[model samples]
Target chain A: MREMIITNNPLVVEKYSERVLFIDGSVEQVLIKVRDMVHRKHGLISHPLPASLRVLFSPYRSVIIGRNNGDINPLQVEIVENSILKYKKHMDVREVDKENNEDYQMIDLTLLESALKDEQVNSMLSGY
Target chain B: MKLEIGRIHIKDIQFGDSTFVEDGVLTVDKAGLIASLKEDERIKDVQVDIARPGEKVRIIPVKDVIEPRVKVEGTGAGFPGVTSKTTQCGQGRTHVLYGAAVVTVGDIVGFQEGVIDMWGEGAKWTPFSKTYNVTVDIQVVEGLEVHTHEETVRLAGLRAAEFIGQAGKEVEPDEVLTYELGGMFEETAKYPNLPKVLYVEMMITQGLLHDTYIYGVNAQTILPSVMHPNEELDNAVISGNCVAACDKITTYQHQNNSVILDLYAQHGKELNFTGVIMVPEHTTLSGKLRVADYTVKLAKMLGADGVIVSEEGYGNPDSDLLMICKKLEDAKIKTVLITDECAGRDGLSQPLADTAAEAVAVVSTGNVSHVVTLPPAEKVIGNPESIAVLAGGWKGAVLEDGTMMCELNAVIGATSEIGYHNVTCRLY
Candidate 1:
């Protein structure tokens, strides 16, 4: 059997005893016990817990959870991978041409900053 | 010496009773005693060869003395003509008379004769006492000579239209045109020391005019009207009859001291000659580029002579100086570099201190025909007279009270066969 707990307070670490602890299944039973212990000791639950967390830890126990359950969903990861692939493809094309290869090199950012501040830079840049 | 009846003398001389002898000489003791001798009965020629033991020797005459007559003559240039006359008496004596005349002092005149009265109721002739008459004269002469030159040329400031009117009146193609630059003339008038801006306006209404060859330094603007004048002189500055139009431009490094380079560049299309642009060494790169652009564009459009870069910093490095020259050359413009090390304490540096030998070197290396530098007022030495002669003549002639004779000579000598261009004079 596994248990899960969720609380608004970050200083509830001593009750868990173990530094690295993971909980799975029977989230409802664990929340009820934690709530009862907090009520008996503190007299009241000052801050409200998240409604989503309450629902997941309600009387409904033995729920089936998916592997992808965190904030980073599958759709976000796919989008990030597509952007990296596109950048690599662009770099590969630029590297194939000798004329375009120079453009791929990184410019000295400090030189660009100084050039922007110079009054005559705009005139010279326009000339180029 | 003579012995008359009124005059007394001892030892075969005439004497009056009142005229006593002292040391064997006749002496006059009474004023009126000489009147007795005039009566012919008192005494005449009373001779005495000797004096008694108790008598005196020297004799004094009892008569008033008469002043001797003198004669004078006049000579030299500018003397008037005159005459003389004489009258004779029975005793081989003649009276001389002189006519009115002018003579200088120390002049000699002939003593013609001596005269006694031979006419009159009681006129008589006696042995005449010798007397001479001399004539005196006075004359005047010039002390100093002063020479001056005037009535040569007449110059007047006129509007563009006036010059056009005069140009219309010209029947010949080679006739000279004249007009004045108004603002320059006005500014020059305000400053007491600056040179006068004499503007010559040329009217190019009809003929095909070569701007450079037609209007030298004196020519400035054009006019729409032949009479009513406009003060917009700068816009009217067209290239006169010369291959190039150039002026010395001085730029300072201090803020707010920028020169209006556009004023010169505006007429770039009209100028056929190069612009000799000068820049101070310490001027910023931005300022140098502006000058360089102005010069390069004008030179490209017109024909740039060259760029002369001068460093006013006394201790500026030669490498930096060479770099400026190199930059100008890289721009495809000819470059001449002047170092400030030779500027000296007299405030003149660079080309001014360049000797003839150094000037030759600059000409050869820089490939420039003309060089500009300050007048050597600091190094100049000698008396002003010698300098004046060396300068070929005085830059200006002034009267004691500081009156300028430049205009006078210009007006007077303008029409003469000989022309005076740069001579200046002052008159009080």
Candidate 2:
């Protein structure tokens, strides 16, 4: 199944032009789009939150969402909504740091690529 | 597999002409080590400094901490896969420069680098304070990409430790501890009446700076796999993190994993120590579900009656932790979990990002958002102003008088989820 790459990371946008939904904003913006998509019944292909809560300080973010079937995935909705809560919880206390956009963009791009590797495993495990 | 660790107690470190250990002190060949590390063209410059216990020294924006060790009687490398050839470890004797650490410091590649105060109120929060630290402050060549820069420092620290670990190969250790775990069937039969306990170690595999490597393979690329405890003890797992400082397990911690140590202590006496199933915490819901199911399945396959699960990093991994816990409990397996919380500044918010009714027994290492004030250090090793951008820090956190205020989130090993540090929580 094809996946949607929702990101504020330019590296991701440049690499995955076809499926990338470029968000020209903060990390929260990319996540919000994922939540909105999930609410509209898209399944969460990748986790919205980065590996570390600290990465929340970085400006760049990338999350993957899979295509929706006819019905909504309760679990996908729950994970994405909870992911927003977790991000807001951390951000509520500390707003994203002042700078380091380049470094963060690189980090976010790396994480996005890491999540993309799950596709291979998914394909491998689907044998009848 | 069985491993015998010989500890050469290192009380202090000093820069000298040659690198070797003698009479509780480690003399480092600073120039030689730096030259060896600089062989990697990515690193432009490397500076070596020492921070011992009770010093007024503070190493900041630190990346990774590795304990130096060398295999005296083993056929493989000290850190297989990443730093050396992929050969089986834990089959012979290894020497450790105990009470010492290779502290990697540099400019922040990500907001997750941490601080280690060698003395004063700050030292109390970090386990690195007690160890004689050999700080490797790396400067990557200008124009190098951030991701490659992070990797440069990571590999440099490993090479530095491998170089320093050579000192232990010839020294007579003050203490020799043995770690041995036999075949699963044999061990289970040997302690047939004991409760079978498995260890589920959740590794962060989000990306470059937020991943753990097992025998050189990224946890992100592998499934939940069974590992002999001895392999980890003999320097198989290495840390690659730039995400969270307080709770992220360093390579040093992996080499001296408290969970593995405790389980081995009670391997045959109190419980049947089955083995370790190293699991990766993923970013996608599908990935998380797949991993959680695989982890529980591996535990069941081992026929575990009880299990100890330790989480690395927090927030997103929180969901993975609970999912695995819920599944394990649903399997009728008694599961006890260890983790840290981000309960806001006043400790008022919920501890984890996700929760479950099945998570009945959980240990809170400490709160990530709990703020602390660290007094000024006479000597600050790395960048002092970098705190403002750290995970647990904020704007104006440096303060006017040099006294810094931040959450435990910025302190190294303050809230180690593996029970390696001094964060205590009790419920009455």
On TM-score, the candidate that comes out on top is: 2
DockQ of each: 0.00, 0.63
Interface RMSD, all candidates in order, equals 43.3, 1.9
Tell me the deviation in Å of residue B150 in model 2. 2.7
**10 residues in a row with least lDDT, candidate 1 chain A:** A45-54
lDDT tens per residue, model 2, A10-90: 888888899889999877888889889988878777777765667766677788887776678887777777878878888
TM-score of each: 0.18, 0.95
lDDT per residue (tens digit) for residues A1-128 in model 1? 11122322122223333421223323233334333333333211111111011011112211111122234433223322332232232222222212211111111111112212232442466463
**Number of the top lDDT candidate:** 2
The clash count of every prediction, one per candidate, is 69, 4
User: In model 1, what lDDT does residue B304 have?
Assistant: 34
The segments of candidate 1 whose C-alpha lies over 4 angstroms from its true place after superposition are A1-128, B1-168, B175-285, B297-326, B336-428
Clashes of 2: 4
Candidate 2 docking classification: medium
